[model samples]
Target: WRRGTNSIAVLGAPQVILYKFGHPSDAWWGVLPYWAGLLILSAPVGLTVYYFLNDHTPPKSTPLAAFLLSLAFISSCVWTDLIASELVSGLEFLGVSLGVSRSIIGLTILAWGNSIGDFVADTALARAGNPRMGAAGGFGGPLF
Candidate 1:
């Protein structure tokens, strides 16, 4: 029932805030050590969405880009938290239904979820013909 390590914060920078997921403090048979790496996809702020709507990058003569960017960012924050919460609840429910303890779910299912991002990013970048940016993304990541 507490906030723990998030995807954007941890996959990007862990030393700053080493968070760990856990069930209720008194629950001895529930989950613990869950590493749910939640990530907000780039479609909200990606160039494709912007280009699809605006037909081009943000213009320098106006504040439209800044305005839209901020709007998207704020919306992202709201949804990310919601999605993360739902994910944990869903996983925990699944664990309970399957007769598996929460701790094991955290250690196994949640941990492997981190690699999903890596797989998607590699495929996306390669298809986009700018795979090098993926490397840069690895170093920079979605930390903003």
Candidate 2:
């Protein structure tokens, strides 16, 4: 049984790589590794954000404060989307220059990068033994 599984894995590996990276002549195999390194480098930045947001309960807010907070949230969302677009565009340009298709970039790089947070959260929930919650999160978290 183990040998059969290993044989299946060996047979499947090349197809998976082909689908992900395309023809060797046209593919940029370094993009995913570069992306992974970026992810690792950004971990500290994410931790810093969590540190800032974790423990502070907002004080009772006046109506003006509430309005300002809402405005700030909206502005931050806009800024985040703007920055994401620029980064994605730059990545897409790099992929095109390397002879990769836009669809491949969108499917692999963009999808994986954007979904990493949901993936991590779901994995953590599963590891914590609340697999139903993790399954639900896996199914539902991407809707937003």
Candidate 3:
């Protein structure tokens, strides 16, 4: 059970690079997750970020900082995928236990997850004889 939980925690199999940023002078650690692995992983990162943001304040923006920030932003996308996969897995298990059809469960979950507004708008547009526009709108609606 512990092994399974640990395996699932690293769902995306992210690369394990050991980045050792020097510690901050002042002692201030933010709220931490209730997991030893996370504590080990995030302590250095949180300290590094604190060191950069508070202590070594940048007067002018550097390209390296921009690139690092972009990578951090991109990590959110990975987190989203991880969270969504867990949600879907839980929903699937519930459906199976409840003796419900997986297809029906999928349809219900997907419709709500993707938003019924997208379905209605896309359908209306496609029915009104513009499928390309409908398809484009369907894909683009979530961006806004």
Candidate 4:
């Protein structure tokens, strides 16, 4: 049973990855990781640049220090993917056991739970410093 389940998970990964890479699904559930990674990787870079270029009162700390501080800002963005995968896996298990529909599990349980990290990371980054940089959409564009 375990082996079969593992095989299914391994095979399913490709479909998920391909779908995430722009398969044009209006309900693209797989793109969350890509979006999260963008936020995670960009926060440090953006904060470093902001510290250097901004004429306004920059962070009192050094560039490296500011960048490090923003590391959490970045990591928080992608942290959801790891967490969400686990959460969704568990939810799916329970849903399957209970004979719940996949569509409901995918849309409500997985989507809402995974999206929580995005919401928190976005809010945290914005509240931490520049609100503009915190936007996932804004940061993802340049990072990619």
Candidate 2 lDDT tens digits, 78-101: 557667878999999999999999
Per residue, candidate 4 scores C-alpha lDDT tens digits across 1-144 of 133332333333434444445442333366555435544545555444444444443345786445444543544444556566677789889999999998998988776765776677778888999688778644573355
Candidate 1, which ten residues in sequence have the lowest lDDT sum? 1-10
Mind giving the per-residue lDDT tens digits that candidate 1 earns over 16-127?
1222222223323354322322212332333333333343333444464464445446556655766787898999999999999999999899867855787679669867
lDDT ranking, high to low? 2, 3, 4, 1
Lowest-sum lDDT 10-residue window in model 3: 12-21
**Which runs of model 3 end up more than 4 angstroms from their true locations?**
1-49, 52-60, 116-144
Model 1 error, position 6 (Å): 28
lDDT tens per residue, model 3, 32-53: 3224444465555444544444
Model 2 regions more than 4 Å off: 1-67
Compare candidates 1 and 3 on lDDT and give the better one: 3
Q: Where in model 4 is the C-alpha error above 4 Å?
A: 1-89, 136-144
Candidate 2 TM-score, true structure as reference: 0.51
Count of clashes, each model: 2, 0, 0, 1
**Highest TM-score, which number?**
2
Q: Give residue 136's error in model 4 in angstroms.
A: 4.1
In model 2, residue pairs whose N, Cα or C atoms come closer than 3 Å (at least 3 residues apart or on different chains), thus clashing, are: none
Is candidate 2 or 3 superior in TM-score?
A: 2
